[model samples]
Target: MTERVYYTSDALEMETDVVSCTRQEDGRFHVVLSATLFHPQGGGQPSDRGTINGVPLLQAIQDGHTLVHIMEGPVQPGKAHLLVDAEVRNLHTRYHSAGHIIGLAGEKFGWLGVKGNHKPGDGRIVFDALATPEPMTIEALATEIGALVQRSESRIITEAEGKRLVTWGTLKPYACGGTHVLNTAEIGDIRLIKMKEKKGQLSVQYELDA
Candidate 1:
């Protein structure tokens, strides 16, 4: 299993040991590191992009408890340098934090979040509701979310139970494992782009200002 450095720190780069490298049938090398700063594609957030041993990493995915770093070039079993793309990391962090903000807004507006997608260009949260509730307009949601972002009180906290929680101001603590900004202020402006209801699910789509 790879030590997940991303859990404790948001450092964009690190030096770690390559535990093993295996060639997959897809023609990519699956590199496992003793520790890594790479955030795998999980928890509605995308994978971190960068290089392992100076070779571009194609993707990072979780295989059971292990995080697999896929690359086009072969890496030997020894010391290696891990570098995460700063720009991509920043964008993912911002989007993920925005999702949490919107989730808080949903709770404030009596909507229960059943799922979330923090991916760039297609970020959204799906809520479970019995009926299409009023005040579901994009304008109303944007207004509420904007207020939360303006407060700039979001912070990450670790509980005695060992769960990492992200709290925005006085709202309820949300358990999340993905990377995020230090505060809601870093999320900047958010725009509600779409909202739809299907099969008793309310999907609220949003995007961050460039």
Candidate 2:
């Protein structure tokens, strides 16, 4: 299994051994590394974009405990260097962290967060009303999330039962595996785009200010 560097560290560049590189039927090479800084496309987050040994990466996917990297070019099985795209990483991290704030706000309002998609430009949190939640307007929820953001609280990451739990300030901790910013202030201004309730689920869509 490739060590998931993105899970525990914020390192953007690193050198590791290339375990294997094989051409697939699609004509792209599947590369495996001893360790990886690239976050694979999963858990509602997109794959990390970057280059490995100068070969452009097409996508990274999770294959059980290991991550398989698809690249546009061939990579020899040997020592290799990886460089993760800082811009893409920052955008995803900020959006993911902000999504947590939305979840925190929803929870405070008696809405239980059941699902979320933290993809940039199309992020949202889905909540299920186990019981009829306290009446909450879209504006009120947005204001609550904004207030949480303005607090500029630091993010805390810890492990429990081998699962990673992410918390913002003293609120509830979420079992998350994606990358995130160190602090809520780094998320910038969060704009609630839309909120709708259907089939006993409330979906709140949001984005960050450019």
Candidate 3:
């Protein structure tokens, strides 16, 4: 199995041995490394884009226990360097961290966060109401989340099952595999786009101020 370096360290560059590199029918190459700082496309987050051995990386996909990195060309199966696009990584992490803050605020309003989509321009969090929420508005929820974001620092802890538990400051922890900011303060201004409730579920769409 490929060791996921992003799980512990958010470093944008690293070096690792290339276990294998094979050409696919589409002319692209599938490269496997000993470990990866590239976060694969999963868990409501997009795949990381960068260069491996100077070759443009397309994306990283999980094939069972191993991560197969798709690249524009092949590099020799040996020690290789990786450089992740900082802008992309930072934007994705901001969306992910913001989602968690929103979830926390929702919980305080009698909603249990159940699902999320942290993709750019389409960020959202879905929740299930446990008890009738004391009349809350989008502005109020945004204010609540903003308060937490200001003082929230992210912490990653490992469990026996090897799952990464992410927590912001003293708030609750969540089992997540996506990249996140070191602190919620880096998430920037969160703007609630829209909120809708249907079929006993509440979906809140949000965006970040550029």
Candidate 4:
């Protein structure tokens, strides 16, 4: 397996690495680096978009053992320095952090168990719960998350089984590989755009203020 420069479950783990890299036929970079803060897109979370050595990375994806960075301009397949856009990284990290914050409603409201729910900015977080919100005024769930944002409490990060863990205000600790902000307050007033229930799954949609 190639070196995973960035591996903690921490989503906000941002850093830059410089090392030997290669350009693929499909127009992607085969990167072998010392260390990387950029996360390869996977697990339903969209791939990250940024630049490598000043060349814009079309996107990043994990292909088995290889972390590929698809780009536009030509790239050199040797040691090259790299930099990541802080803004892009932060946005992705914030969404990831918000995802966990949003899960609080289910965990607090009570859930039997939930699975297959991805981070926010992609879709809804749905799982088994003692109760799902009613069709009308389901927005209360979003309001609950808003309250957390209002509290602006710092979220603590830990490590378990090689994955970064985040915990907030008695909410269930979650294991994830994406980047995240330092605190729940950084989520910054997200708005739940929609809510739906289909085939016994509760789905809530939320977006950060732009």
RMSD to true structure for each model, in Å = 1.8, 1.1, 1.5, 3.7
Error of 2 at 101 (Å): 0.8
* TM-score (all chains, Cα) for each model: 0.93, 0.96, 0.94, 0.78
How close to the true structure is residue 83 of candidate 4, measured as C-alpha lDDT?
A: 62
lDDT string for model 3 (14-133, tens) is 999999999999999999999999999988898999999999999999888889999999978999999999999999989998899999999998998999999989999999988687
Report the candidate with higher lDDT, 1 versus 4: 1
Q: Candidate 1 lDDT, tens digit per residue, 67-184?
A: 8999988999999998999999999999998888888787666688878899989999998863445456778888999998888785756765778877766767888888888888
Residue pairs with colliding backbones in model 2 are none
lDDT of each: 0.86, 0.89, 0.89, 0.63
Better of 3 and 4 by lDDT: 3
Please provide, for model 2 over 114-141, each residue's C-alpha lDDT reduced to its tens digit, 9 standing for 90 to 100: 8889888899999998665888899999
Which stretches in model 4 have alpha-carbon errors above 4 Å? Answer: 1-23, 112-122, 130-137
Q: 106 in model 2: Cα distance from truth in Å? A: 0.5
- For candidate 4, write residues 72-105 as lDDT tens digits: 7665655555566667767766776677777775
How well does candidate 3 score on lDDT at residue 145? 88
